[model samples]
Target: MEIPNRGKNIMKTLCLAIVLGGLALSSALQAQPSEDTVSVPVSARQLRIDLPDAYSKMWPEDYRDLVANYSLSNGQTLSIISRGTNMYALVDQGPPHKIVSTSRNNYVALDRQLKMEIVLGGDQGASGSVTMVVPSRSLSDGRFVPEQVVLLAFR
Candidate 1:
């Protein structure tokens, strides 16, 4: 009788801890996007959030519109598809683009046509915009150079 009672008490304590932990986690996740969701740009397919491991992990079931097929500034349309766990960008008349690097809310893609690096991320300056950086031509000293940076944001 004593042994059974002790086991029951231990089980009860464990169950209580698990329940509390779950409640705390649920609240934290809920608070993340409610404040910013309204500010997301209309053209933006999804929140400018970094996947847990660069699409190596499945997207949350609650997220919608996992794919973004849009035209780049260079007049080339790139199609990026999400297979729930990973994303690949299909370049026009070129090979599929792989993720060069990734962070919490940003990633870089290397393109062959423009032969430059593109950075996509959330814009801290704008409440509901995405930041994009592409190559640009500028006069440096006495000659033209491709070191200029251009920022295109979607509001």
Candidate 2:
């Protein structure tokens, strides 16, 4: 049995259309922006604070005006206290750091001497976490090191 010429031509045309459709679909997909290439807007503000103590201070015996307290996963306690218009973070009875609010629930504390930044974010008066970006030291010369990010969860 031999296929008709007309039928062969129709089959060839269908195959070509399918091939072209596939190519078009592939090209359309390629033209789309990749999920990995995301651009986020960043805003930087310069803040100057004057305090009697360092950014972080030990848990004060007579501390007042408590705002929120969280317990970290590493058996550490983090307390946020308010004094006038500023907020302070006292971690595990350690030194308190003056954390400046960036947003409704986002706060950041910077140590210029150590070139370290600590970012705290999450629902205020609820669960939250702290992220510390600290500068790393080069093993060879103890200088020219990159920054290391450390995340600590709290509740």
Among these predicted structures, which one has the highest lDDT? 2
How far is each candidate from the true structure, as Cα RMSD in Å?
Answer: 24.8, 22.4
Tell me the spans in candidate 2 whose CA falls farther than 4 Å from its real position: 1-66, 112-125, 133-148
TM-score of each: 0.30, 0.39
TM-score of 1: 0.30
Please give the lDDT score for candidate 1: 0.39
TM-score of 2: 0.39
Write model 1 residue lDDT over 16-113, tens digit each, in one string. 43454465557556656675453333553321223233432325341223355545433444555655555555544445554433443344444322
Error (Å) of candidate 2 at residue 144 is 17
Candidate 1's C-alpha runs over 4 A off are: 1-66, 109-155
Residues 1-155, model 2: lDDT tens digits: 68766445433333443454466557556665785653322441222222223333323442333366776544455677766656677654546677654443455554421111333443444556665433344433444434434345664
Candidate 2: give the clashing pairs: 55-97, 56-95, 56-96, 56-97, 57-95, 57-96, 58-95
Model 1 weakest lDDT span, ten residues long: 125-134
lDDT of 1 at 62: 19
